[model samples]
Target: MKPLVWIVALAVLSYSTISGMVGHDHHVLIIAGATDGYLSPCGCVKPMSGGLRRRVTAIKQLSVPNMTTVIETGGFVKDSGRQDQMKAEAIAETMKLVKVAAINYGLEEARLGAGMAASLDRLSGEALVATGLGGGAIPVKKFKVSGPFLIGGIDPRIEQIGAALGSKLEPIDESVRALTDEAKESKLVPVLMTRGDLESAEAIAKKHPSLRLIVCSVKSSPYDAPRRVGDTLIVTPGEHAKYVVRIEWDGQAFTAYRFFDLGPEYADDKQAQEVYTAYLARVTSEDLLSMVPRSETDVFAGSAACAPCHAAEQRVWKASAHSKALATLEKEGHDRDPDCTGCHVVGLRSVNGFRSRAITPNLTDVGCESCHGPSKLHAMNPTKHKLAKVGKESCMPCHNTEHSPTFDFDAYWAKIKH
Candidate 1:
């Protein structure tokens, strides 16, 4: 009887190993939405979630494979002091560190105007490639990876649509058809990360049955219902703003698993205030001045001038949320308003030439003093006088209800690459 039992156990083990009968045996991890510099303050709540450090830790722990492919849907661009170039630089650095597979450019990528966007693509390291479905495709050196995985990027618009009647309709059919053809020829699944609506995506998927997954970014919709059209899977990140979806292919079929924690929603009262207060203390006026080198007496040199002397600090500031604030405001059209211009501009009303009205200096753009308060006192002393240092309280003035939907420091910080 003991010999018979042993034989049966051996047979069972053999079957499990050969057949791959375990349901969850193939493990794959997919992480998305590290918007980084694009974050804003949610009501009174300070940023509590998302940053590169935490993200790196999370990825390190999950390094074991069945397989893992991390994809960012979009929104990697944000106005960082001079331009949106810093956002791309920061993203490239982070991707290099985290080893992300591919990224689709969001609508914000176009915010740096057309020329700057091209420059950003050039700056990102060779490991990452930027591809699009239509004429906007930028060629990158091919990267070799093992397994039956295919990563492709698609730009949302086919033709540039200016404000005009009947301009609403553009020819995206050809682009989708081309992408589908490419996928079928390569025997690889096609994933789309775009700013288009679900309805538009469903329409496109209808024509291209080979496109398996359509991951929508830029829109916040409910997640309970993941629309399936033909053989494609349509999903949006929803309220759990950032999410991870794991796709496993076993030489036969593909299965997906999604994991996300949106953190907490912004509350109007005390908790929000406390979080804001804490975040502000982290960066103050004195802190900003300290970041500038004492050797550089020209305080008006802007962010680029400070970069050479304080390489490490400049790297950190380049990745910070404050740097991108002006660009975000401008993109959102808040730059036109006086109320918003003050905070978004370096020195709005001060004699230190920090105001947006200083066109000759080109200080209208977001700069160091935007978060550090006025630099007048710090400039006067250079070394002796200390301006107000930023603290959690300092961040609240801008990060509160006036700016973002919800702010999680940890989540926001996790997205920053530098």
Candidate 2:
């Protein structure tokens, strides 16, 4: 009887595994609004969540045996310029590798301008599903993810102060209605993707109850399970590449939906790591950041110039890690790198700030100017350039959560205080 029971249990377990494999023969990953850049896990600080390497690794793991298609819902990278352009390129290439079925061009991509978007579209090949950029205004994109599975993106029009960074704003209601109608004609399971707030998403659902799944983009929040809204389901995988959301289809309804957290536990994919490392190398090599001309008003005054006025503070600064910020980068051979040099040195990106160790040796390191703002004027009139506030707002430029996750203003201030 005991032997029979053991055999029955084994059979049940085997059957379960087989059933799972069969059910998940075709898998689709919905990544929404990460605001993840190409060379991320920014700052390389420990306990970091996601990066390109981990994202690639997770995609590779999911692609085994099962047919996988990754649909990215934009907000690709935050911030702009040459570095952002490079990061977009990286995202396009990685999408090619992981076979990204579609991309809902988020605001970040739009900000790259139309010329760059067309270039990336050419690069993505067959992977870039649909032109999320519709006639005049556009929602992200709505594309076919093989079989009858379809994914669509919904993004608000950006026409406020910095409208040039965005495309024309199409009425959301009309766009969603049209896309859903198109998908329904082909008998496709249209899934809506968004990088907006919950209120906007709910409004869309209210208007178009036909959309059963809505993948959302969030900033600095934990992954939320699918929440039912009328007949539609809204879910977010959180920001950054911190998590990848997977949903399995049984040819009817979604059988399983789970998020794979990409943390330090997983080993990095060598190729993706090379991509990120190469980006780091390029930023350092090209010295692109140095091109940003500093203003005349914000001039750098050497840290030494301020030493006499605040002797005790200078002493504390000299003793603190901020004192040798450049040397730390130098040890890693990134001292000359713009990304490194900018934060490590005083006024590196400002008026008359550190240019290089050779050009502005006096300005190198997190000098008093870094915290107190550029002070060429202060040297002439010490009382005029007094800081208004020296709190979180002041330090976060470099000491942000991306750079120092463990940072606490009170505790850190205590250590470096005069």
Candidate 3:
């Protein structure tokens, strides 16, 4: 009887020891990301909704105890210019400050043509990529929050790009099976991070229901709620840094999934602002706005050029925000910034439009020519001038939803209608 009691007591003690080794009281895994190059919110609209600085404040508040693992998936620069490169680098630095564990490359990052991706990876401390294909660690982190293992994958659609970045390609089902076996044997949790779509994730999930969670990168639409595919939960952080998935684990499995909406409620992190300002400074240094010779298509005949011909329209323009757009950038010290100035200036980077302050000084600010089309040929001879028509498509180049979210052609046109 005594021997049997001792054996039962020892078994109970062993169970307790194993559980302690595998679990913690409060293990939180912050599945954060920037799927596309929406590092900052579009300032075209007031009371801007999302920005990395505000997101930083939210992340800081959530990670109070330093018991969190942050991961950034793929995102790309809208413009591949030197200034944009600086912006991307600043984004990476900001991630580092929050102690992000890894970043997986997606189609956008791959589209950077390998060389640029490599440069970005280097500038980002190589922490930007966590590839298992090119001989990376099986489990990207050793944190016991969601067990001690993790796996990352790139989209097959960008396989060539992944290959260029040195990540090998393999069948998802096979990889999942083999990886899961390996993780199980090693006593590690298996989490799958992919740049693939929902269908691909579902297929993988059906075969490997044991996976802790599947983090999918989305573009067109973000998941409004978590969906269960097989025994795994497929989740994504909505686009544009609008929301971050805050997951809590009991060291066994996720206990709660809290997705916080980063809105006007959150304040900006001053430190992140410094990094962003530094990036803007780099843009100023590149001199991307240096004067260039205007081409034959039609030069930017500043709004003033049109004022002499159309006094009513000129009055409407001057009183409108479009006329003072460049001034606004000047107020923020971004007057010379290639990213902001392009949209604000008349044909700043358009076809044979405004080139620079040195040569096309008059082209500064959004002008009649910006929407009415380049009028160098027409301006010199108005009777000969002819515009086929004006349409919403023409205005969308700068007034699209991402930047000018509240833009309504009817309302905006009414404001500037001559």
Give the candidate number with the greatest lDDT: 2
| TM-scores of all candidate predictions against the true structure | 0.52, 0.77, 0.81
- Summing lDDT over every window of 10 consecutive residues in candidate 2, give the lowest-scoring window: 131-140
Q: Write the per-residue lDDT of candidate 2 for residues 338-396, one digit (tens) a residue.
A: 55577888886566778887888889888987877877787878688665566677888
Question: Clashing pairs in model 3?
Answer: none
Q: Model 1 TM-score?
A: 0.52
State the lDDT of candidate 1 residue by residue for 1-418, as single tens digits.
Answer: 6743543454344324432432443434354553645332221234343343334444443344445566665566444333235445555545545466665553455444445445644544333333432233332312213245555454465343212111232245654565566667777656655457788778778877787777665345335445789878777643222333444544545554333333232122332233323323332322332232223222354555555545886677767765776676656444534335556656555544443333524454556655555444455555785655664565466556536446565665465433
TM-score leader:
3
Model 2 C-alpha RMSD vs. true structure (Å) is 7.3
Q: Backbone clashes per model, in order?
A: 37, 3, 0
Between candidates 1 and 3, which one is better according to TM-score? Answer: 3
Candidate 1 CA-lDDT value? 0.48
TM-score of 2: 0.77
Off by over 4 Å in 2: 1-26, 30-33, 36-38, 129-142, 158-170, 297-319, 330-340, 368-402, 408-410
Per-residue CA lDDT of model 3 for 6-116, tens digit only, reads 434543453344333324455666666753556666567665556788778877766635456776665645545565566667777777778766666555665555566
Clashing pairs in 2: 34-240, 132-140, 132-141
lDDT for residue 200 in candidate 2, whole number 0-100: 78
